[model samples]
Target chain A: MHELAPPLTLEQGLRWLDLIGILAFAMSGALLGVRKRFDLFGVVVLGCVTAVGGGAIRDTLTGQTPPLFLRDETYLWMALLGAGLGFALGEGLARFERTLSVFDTVGLALFAASGAVGAINFGLGPLGVVFAGMLSGVGGGIVRDLIANEVPEVMYRRDQLYATAAAAGALVVVLLHPHVTSFQAQLGGALTIVALRWLSRRGWVSLPVRRVPGARD
Target chain B: MHELAPPLTLEQGLRWLDLIGILAFAMSGALLGVRKRFDLFGVVVLGCVTAVGGGAIRDTLTGQTPPLFLRDETYLWMALLGAGLGFALGEGLARFERTLSVFDTVGLALFAASGAVGAINFGLGPLGVVFAGMLSGVGGGIVRDLIANEVPEVMYRRDQLYATAAAAGALVVVLLHPHVTSFQAQLGGALTIVALRWLSRRGWVSLPVRRVPGARD
Candidate 1:
C-alpha cells in the first residue's frame, strides 16, 4: 500500500505537470515546423495543435464537452508561449534535443496515465482504456508528424519501445486502479512507462518484428 | 423557394446516402492498405477508421456521445462489407476507381453538409461551423493517408479545390440556415460542393500555391 498526498497538493502537482507537458509538446511541434520551413502561421498552428491534440482527443472520446483546453485558455496561452520560444530560438534549440526528449518522455507518461484514468471514469472496458491511454500519449506527436508530412515515429520506430511503453503503462494503471487510490495508480503508471522507455533505450527490451514475404527491400 | 419532402422520407434517404458514403470510404481505405501490403487486420482497421472517422470527429466536436456509428451497427456492417470486397477484389478494384471516386465525392459533400448542420445545432460560430464541415468531408481521407505514411492529398493537391469546396458548401449551409429548412440547406450545401469538385476536376478552378524562400526542392 502507498501513502497518498493531500488532495489539494496532488491536484496542484498534476496541474503543473500538465502545463510542463503542454509547453514541451508545443515547442517540439513548433521546432519541427520551423525545420520544415512552414510559414509563421503554420508554425503557430502546428504548435497549438500538437499541445492540445492528445487531450482534446481523450476528452472527445469520453464525451467531455468543448474540450479541456478550450475551457481553460491558460493551456492555449502556454502553447503560444512555447511556440514563440521555439520559433524565435530556431536552430539554437536543436542543441537541447536530449533535454527536450526527457520532457517529452515525461509528457508521454503522464498523458497515458491520465487518459487511462479518464476512460475508466467514463466506464470504458480494459481494451478501450488501454487504447485510449496509448492514443493520448502519442496522438499529439502523430498529428505533428502528419502535418509535417513525415511518417509518425511512434508507428515506425520499432528499434526502441514508444507506443509499447505507453500501452504497458496504461495496463499498469488499469491493473492497479482497483487496489489503489487514483493518484497512486496514476503515479505508478507514469513511473512504469518512464522506466520501460529508459530500459528500451539501453537495449534491455524490444518488441518483435517480422519481414513480410515479397516486401520491398 | 423549395418543396420539402416528408420527414420520414427525407430521413430514410439520408440514411441510405450515409451508408453509401461509408461503403465508398471503406473501400478506398482498404484499397490503399492493400496497395501498401498491410496485413488483413491492418486493411480492415484502415477501412473502418476511414469510414467512421469523419462523423466521429463531427459528433465528438458537437458533444455527442458514443458517435453515430457506435450507436448504429449498420454503418460498421457496411464498412466491413466494403473492406471485404476490396480485399477479395484486390488490384481488380483499381479499374473501378472512377466509379468509386464519384461515390467518394457524394460522400464528401453530404458529410460536409451534415457536419455544418451539426455545428450549427451546437451553436458554433460561422468559422467553426465551416471548419467542422470541411473536416467532416476530408477528415477520413486524411486519416487514411496518415496511416499509410503519405502526405495528405487534400493538403498538397492545390490543382483542385477539395477542402475549399467543402468550406464553400458549408458557407452555403450557414447562409441558408435561417431562410430555409435544415434538409433543404443541407441539400443545397452538398450540391454546391459536388458542383465545385466537378468543375475543379475539369480544370476550371484551382487554389494557389507559393514557394517559400530558401525552401528545399
Candidate 2:
C-alpha cells in the first residue's frame, strides 16, 4: 500500500470557494426540481442530494462513513437554504443561467481538487484518485438527473465537457502533489479546471459524437 | 458506536443460496440489457452493475472500501458469465418470466438477509441495519432501471411489493438477531421475504396508490 499524505485543512480562500460551490450546486438541483414541477419535499431533497451527493459517494467509496453532512448538519442546512431560495426565486432564476453556470464551474473545480486530495490521503492509486475526483465533481448532477428519471446529461451530452473538466483538474492535482504543497496543487488544479470549463462553454466547444451511417431521420 | 459481531463464514447451504441469487440477479440485468438493445459491453456492464450495485452502495455507505467484488474476483467473473448467458439466451429468456421471477425472489431474499447481517456487523443501529439491508436488496435494480432511463419499478410500481419484501426481510433479521443466532436469523429472514413476495404475487396484492384528486387524463 502506498503511504498517503496527512489530511490538510483548507485555507480561508478555499473554504469560501467550497461553500460557494455547495450553494451553487444546491441551487442548480433545486432549479431542476422546480422545472420538473416537484413538490416542496422533492425540491429540498434534490437540493441536498445535489450539494452533498458527490462528496458523500467519494467518502463512502473511500471508507469514510456517515459522510460529512451526517457528521456536521451545516451542509444539510445550507442545501435546505438553497432549496428555499430556488423555490422563492422560481422561474426568475432562469434568467441567471449564465451566472449559475459560472458558479457551477467553480464548484466543479473545487470538488475535483478536494476529491483528488482526499483519495490520495486514503492511499488510493492514480486511477482511484482520478475517479474519485471526477465523481465528486459530477456525481451530484448525475443523481439529480437519475431522480428526475432521465439519462445523465454528462454521459450523453456531447456538448458539455463536464466530466472532462473534472478529470483534468484531478489529474493536475495528482501530478503536482509530489512536488508541491497540497494547497498549491489544489489551487492550480481548480484554476485550470475553471478556465478550461469557462472557455469551453464560451466557445461552444464540444466533444465529438459518433453517428451511425444512414441513421439520420 | 455499538460493538459489531465477528464476521461469519457462509455455511454450505447459504453459499449455494448466495450463488443462485447472484446468477438470478445477473440474468435479470442481462435480460434487461438485451431488451434495451444495448451493445455487448453495455449488456455486460448492466449485468454486473445490477448484480452488485446494491451491495456496493450499502458497503460504501457503511464505510467498507474496495467492496467485496474488488477484494474477490469471483463476483466479477460470475457477473460476466451471466451477461454472456443473457446475450446467448436473448429474448428467449423473456418467455420464462415466471421462473425468472422465482429466481429473482430468491435473490432478493438472500440479499436482504445478508445485507442486514452485514450492517449489524458494521455496528449499525436498527434503522441503519434495516435501511442497509433493503438497499442491498433493491439498490442494484434501481440502478439498472436508471441506466435504462426509466423510473425504478419499486418506487412507482405499486403492483409489485419489491421494496416492501426486501424491507420485511431486513426487518426480520434485525428483530430476530438478539433472540437467534446469525445463521438462524438470516435463514428465517430470507424465507419470510421469499414467502411474502411469492404470496403477494399470487394474490395480486398491490399497495394502494394515492391519486391526485383533480388529476385528469
Candidate 3:
C-alpha cells in the first residue's frame, strides 16, 4: 500500500506532521463532545472520527480503501489518547482555546500538503489536487459538526479561511513540484497554509458577501 | 475487485434493487435541498452524495477503493436525473409522501442485504457484518441531514424503526448465509426488513423512551 511504503525524507516529514495534526484534531473533537454532554463512548467516537474522517474521505474518493488509519494502529491510538486527555482535562482545557486553534492550524496545513501530494501521485490534475487537499483539511470538521447537528463551520463561515488556505497551499505544492525537491515543495506548501491562516485570523479577513441586485441591504 | 465481479443471480437481483433505491434516495435529498433554499448545484450535489454516501462509507471500511459508484457512471446519471425530477416537480412530489416512504423502504431492505453480503465476503465477523449492513442502510440519510443542518433522524428519533429494522434484517442474512443459497439468503433477509419496516409504519410502532429515575419527571 502507498501509505505503508518506506518513507523518503519528504514523506517522513509529512508523516510526522500528520501525527501531530491527528492528535490535535482528536482533542478538539473530544472537547466538542464533552461540551455537548455526550457519554464517554460518544466522546471517543467523535474524537477518532474527527481525526480520521477527512483522510478517509480523500482515500475513498481516490480509490485507496481501508484508509491509512485502518492500515496502521498508530493514528488510531493517538486519536484515542488525545480524546482521553481532552476528557480528563475537561473544562480546564477550554481555557486554552488559542492553543487549540494553533494545533488546528498545524493540522490543516499538514493535511492539505499530504492530500495534494497523494492526489498528484494518483495522477490527478491541478483541480483535483487542490480539491483533494482542501477536502482533507476540512472534511473532519464538517463531519464533526454534522454529527453535532450544526451547520459545517467551513461551508458558510466566510471569515474562517479554512478551505481557502488549504487550496492556496495545495496550489503552491502543485506549482513547485516540477522544479523543487519533494521535501522543499511539501514544506513550502504547508508553511504557506499556516501563514495564510494565521494572517487571516489576526486580520479577521473574510470573503465578501453579496446581496441580490433588487434586494434591500 | 469485489465490486467488479460478474453478476450472479443474487448480484443481479441486488443490482436492480440498488437502481431503484438510488433514484428514490436521490429524489429525497434533492427535495431536502429545495426546502433549504439551496442553489441548483447544491441540490444536485446533495442528491448524489445522499444516494452514494452510505455505500462509499461501507466500501472504505472494507478496503474497497474507488467505490462502486465511481467505477460506474450509471449510478451518477440516475442520481442526477432524480434530482432534476425533484427540482422540476417541486411541491407536487410532496403529495406523494406515502409513495416515497415505500420507495425508501425497498431501498433500505436491498442496501442492508448487499452490505451484509459484502461484509461476509470480506471475512468480517457476524457483528461487523450487521454493523456494516445497518450503516449502509442509514449512511445516506445521516449525510443528507448533516448537510442540511438537521439532527439525523436515525440518531435521535426513537420513534423511527430505521436502524433497528436494518440490524434485524442483516442478522438474518448472517444467520442464513452458511446454510442457504446466496440468492435465497439475500432475498429472505431483504424481505424480512421490508416486512418489518412496513408493519412498523402501519402500526405506528416505536421504541420506548426512558428517563433517569431521579433526574427528570
Collision pairs in model 1: none
Answer with 1 or 2, whichever has the higher DockQ. Answer: 2
Which residue pairs clash in candidate 3?
A63-B66
lDDT of 2 at B213: 94
Q: Evaluate candidate 3 and give its CAPRI docking class based on DockQ.
A: incorrect
TM-score of chain B of each: 0.93, 0.91, 0.90
Q: Candidate 3 residues B49-114, lDDT tens each?
A: 788889878987787765666556677677778877776666567887789888888889998888
Residue A70 in model 3: shift from native, Å? 12
For B20-75, candidate 2 gives per-residue lDDT tens digits of 77777888988887676655545655687788788788877776786765445566
- Regions more than 4 Å wrong, model 2: A1-10, A202-205, A208-217, B1-52, B61-63, B66-141, B151-217
Residue B56 deviation, candidate 1, in Å? Answer: 1.9
Q: Give the TM-score of each candidate.
A: 0.61, 0.60, 0.59
Kept native contacts, as fractions per model, are 0.21, 0.25, 0.27
Return the candidate ranking by TM-score, descending: 1, 2, 3
Scored by lDDT, model 1 comes in at 0.85
Preferred candidate (TM-score higher): 1 or 2: 1
